[model samples]
Target chain A: MEISTTKQFDLHRRMVRIRLFEEAAGRLAEANRLPGFLHLYVGEEAVASGVCGALNDDDHITSTHRGHGHLVAKGGDFNRMMAELMGKATGYCKGKGGSMHISDTSLGMLGANGIVGAGSPIAVGAAFANRYRGRGQVAVAFFGDGSTNIGAFHEAANMACALHLPIVFACENNEYGEFTPRHKTMAITDIVDRAAGYGMPGVIVDGMDVIAVHEAAVEAVERARQGGGPSLIEAKTYRYYNHHGIQNLGLKYRPDEEVATWKQRDPIFTFEDRMIENGVATREKVDEIWAELRQDIETAIQFADDSPYPTPDQIMVDVYTKSSTTIGTKS
Target chain B: MTRTASIVGMIVNPNAGKDIRRLVTPATHTSDVTKVGIVRRAIVAAFESGASKVLLMPDNHRLAERASDRIKGDIEVLDMPLSGSRFDTIAAAHVFCQAQVGAVIALGGDGTSRDVAIGWPDAPLIAISTGTNNVFPSAIDGTSAGAAAAFVASGAVCLSVVARRSKKVVVKIDDRDKSLDDLALVDLAFINSMFVGARAVRDPHTVHAVISCVATPASTGLSSIAGRIHPVGRWETGGVFVRLGAGGRKVRVPLAPGSFTTMEIAEVRRLGEGEKISLSGKTVLAFDGERDLPVSAFGTVTAHIEATGPLLIDVEQTLVLAAQALMFDETARHISEGNHVY
Candidate 1:
């Protein structure tokens, strides 16, 4: 599929937004400003940007723990997301659900699940809803390669195939599941092959290349929406930061050379180069977009900082429907 | 080679009737079995009324699938790949809008219809009451509701002729400058509490009801309080605002099924459409019987009624028109003449 200049520009802009958001999050974590675990999606920006760019506003998506990039790519309000990270009352969950649990149902973002492989079933449900309603909307589940081993992922895949649900299980093989490398954790080298077991098509794409991921996603999403059951997409990518915090935690496991090699293929720089080479965007224009995104990220951080924390009384609210007085009951 | 077919969408919320009210009040539980049966009847009725396709929203319990299993029409059970939640309803609404479905028959109460409205604000809806607090949807037979929906969906009865744009309570947080913060189909209550625990307004003393459209005295829940005092008609252009507190006229109100509470009404007044009522205090604002927003003592929340809600399909009116126009008779005659129809 040939991508238009406008679409290419949009892909580039989305990637830049994710990168800037992740970098800002890393800085805040380093400065001890953000609470809870901060899993940065630094180098994995292409997968989210490309996949989400191919989706309509009505298409639902479920994200992983390191989901800021996915949320940003799906047009989530950065101000509300940043406030969520700060545990403010103005957050998506009204401060009850922090970074790992942020959800904006209005935007078709099911949520950012803290548990491994939790979002797969959620995405399947969304896809089922789409097909059941005959709306032809697709749901995409964005997870790490580590999540592939979880039972929920396999169960969801099998169920999706059996029901011919319109869903895409996009696995971001960032090469690591927290501290353990992908090779150490799983026997299978390519997660996409697993789709064959569930009787669905599978594709592997260069996670560092926005164009490749976008093209593959467009095909997969279109096919799913057109009644073609589910598909598994393995995005071969790497994460720049440590699994959890800004601290590298000694970087004792992986070879230093591997990190250097992956950095050389940084998705943002590669995509920017492609944009300029294709004459889709000028270096000046890309730079301007990056600069503007940086300003936006700064504003978001300020908003989060200025936002108030939820009051004690709010802790009991939103636990269920808005009115039951069931909170604080030991039973 | 080509045929135009009307599609009617059905959304069933299995979680609607299974609320805290089941444990607290004498409200009857609507089992998954009954919901499935209702959906099946609705689908069959829609097909009989010339709906060529029936689209059902998938649920966790396989409600829609089971309902459509024995049916042989163009029934498509939506693919919900994940576990069922309220979001599924909203997502299905978006799909129905995209598919240009003739009309939607929502099988739940106010909350279920609200979810559909959120997804497709102007969708033509046949809201059926199957939940505890049901003020928006009426207690109508599924078969009749489906037939009416089919008439609207298939263009046998014009939408304008059979439906009217219902009223909605548009809520604004703080200033009335921002976009509509939230909305409620029947009632918006400001409760003198901070937490939204259990989600239902159990205690009558905690509520200050602001209702749009009509609240029948025969109905139950918070809307009944307003209906009992100052009954507002469905087409009335304004709303009723009632303050509940001490040292006021006492009135017996049924807060839930088999649960009647005497509420002290401090004040009750009629507010015209577009007239803003500012609520400021340490409270939580409950919409459509569920508490959702928490307002600080200094915070101000504004609410006003507007004719911007979903176009509710009058089932009786639609069926009546279909009869008067000989739609049912035409189908019967066609069948008697051995004229095959899909």
Candidate 2:
């Protein structure tokens, strides 16, 4: 009820942008423009868009390998992202850090980590720094259900709770940590239950509904900023695409019927339908938004294609500690 | 007549008991070794090795005194009077210099070793792993460590050969009363999102670093930025510092954090000496891999990378020699002949 019409509409637009971005990335991969493997954030856009919307620019966030939506929702630039995927000099890491390692610290989006459950400790450490400095900063770490099974997660949670660090653990329970379903890997169905072990609040939200996720995130972010320590929020969501490439080819672990059932809850379509029914937006307005996003993506692609490759000499940089006096010289 | 050697300095950490494997006691198998045993062994080893003077870096428990009384060698074990944090190994290094110890041996994991190294770059150090993660310390027996110290004391191996020094960065925050341990070699940030604590453990937000020159293996901290960049150091030396401010905007880069999300970098600048990089707020500075002091607001932290001087012993080399002696060697014969086997 606290959400205004404009905020809800903005969330809807962000969710669509994430979906379209992944869809386009998948197509670009097929065209052989994007090198390396790509993980699409097709179904879990709501979780990223909603949770990220709850944070301010100064708030920090750590992401997983499937972090495009998280990055975009956190306000990452599309042109730079496309340039990076193309491995152009203009890319974020100057074409050095590809998909898995992409980070924009400016946006409070800590770089997405490749290791499963590896980003948790770094987040905890950041939260500890924030608390120690007495800064009103909060840290958010986004991972999947697969990561919850990691021991590092448990240790970090216990430590964060014990130390009263301001952090929010957003677990996107996509039911699969790769090919294996949650039931196969974990005993409990609800990942939020993991929070009880840390002696903190655990929340479960309908991740398909962006509003639900937003409300949950707002509550968690406020609590953390106010020095209420940490909380665990499990957003039940799913991935429409395969773990990486385009081949779903009949999920051996999950029945075909289940996939069909979850697709019915596709966040984009649900939000669109709700917007039209509630008189919040017309089909034309939604179409306009999509068109704008598509055009933006096209511009991004063009920018990346036109951007020159980094100078060959530029190859030997961004790795070690560079001194101010030693600029232009190879370390 | 054999002249007894005097122990110049002893840098003892009380936490070495946290990670010792005891096969003799089945009940306490794989548990933390008793702190008293560690202290006792360290002090006794120092005494027997001709340590006539000692400087102890004990925890708040005053564990150094208990170890001093148990030693048979006539040695002066003076406790390092420390203020501020007990784990502030940097402060303790100043104490070692004041004590005028010829060599300083530290007992801790990579972070602890890095801490001591940052504090006393020129002081000789012996690293012992007592922490969970260890990449720098030599996983050797305490007796071997003691023997190695004695060798350094006896002029068996040159001091320059025993401690190898790497390049270090010194951050002097404008008007601040402290120094930083490790500046972020890549990127540092303050994260605000929430996930499970462990799963979110990724790299540090590196604000200022001498990235164009240093390199290391897969570290969870700043050095991993070098790993992300094409292996430059193993092939050649290179580094860069990317400033990531508080914006989620993507600066797309080719390097991936691990195997997942693609990263967007902000701005990449070539660092040089005497370059003035001003930070907005007083940010906390971490070094090598451990968190250090914070930079206060209105405080300016100048990061400059310079070659550090320390003759460090290679664990691989020492292990090779130890293996030769234990299996079959002239050194082993001499040790046995001298009745040095304990």
Candidate of highest TM-score: 1
Per-residue error for A307 in candidate 1, Å, reads: 51
lDDT of 1 by residue, B1-342 (tens): 122568899999876664445434566656567787888899989988878799989875568887898788899988755334568998999899988898999988888888898888998999998888788898888899989888788777788887999888888776333334778888888886534534667767677655545577988888888889988877788788888877778999899978998998888899899898887656678888877666655667888898888999999998888787777885552212112222
Error of 2 at B61 (Å): 50
Give the CA lDDT, 0 to 100, for residue B246 in model 1: 77
lDDT by residue for model 2 (A1-331), tens: 2456788777887888788778878888878888776788898998998888888888888888888888889888888887877778888878877777778988888887889898788789889887888768899989898998898888889999999899999989888889887767865556765675777777666678786687678778888898777887778788888887465456576767777878988888887776675456899998999999999998988998999878888877988866667768866
Stretches > 4 Å off in candidate 1: A1-331, B1-4, B80-83, B175-180, B330-342
Native-to-model Cα distance after best TM-score fit, residue B320 in candidate 1, in Å = 2.0
Q: Would you estimate the TM-scores of all the predictions? A: 0.50, 0.48
Report backbone clashes per prediction: 29, 117
lDDT by residue for model 2 (B1-342), tens: 122433445554543322111100111111123333454565565444434555666543344565566566655545545531334576677676665565566665455655566566676766665533333454555555655654444333345554566444444556355544343322233231121111112223333332333434443234444335422242222334545544534422312122222344445555444343545444445444333444445555556554453445554454344454462253442231122221
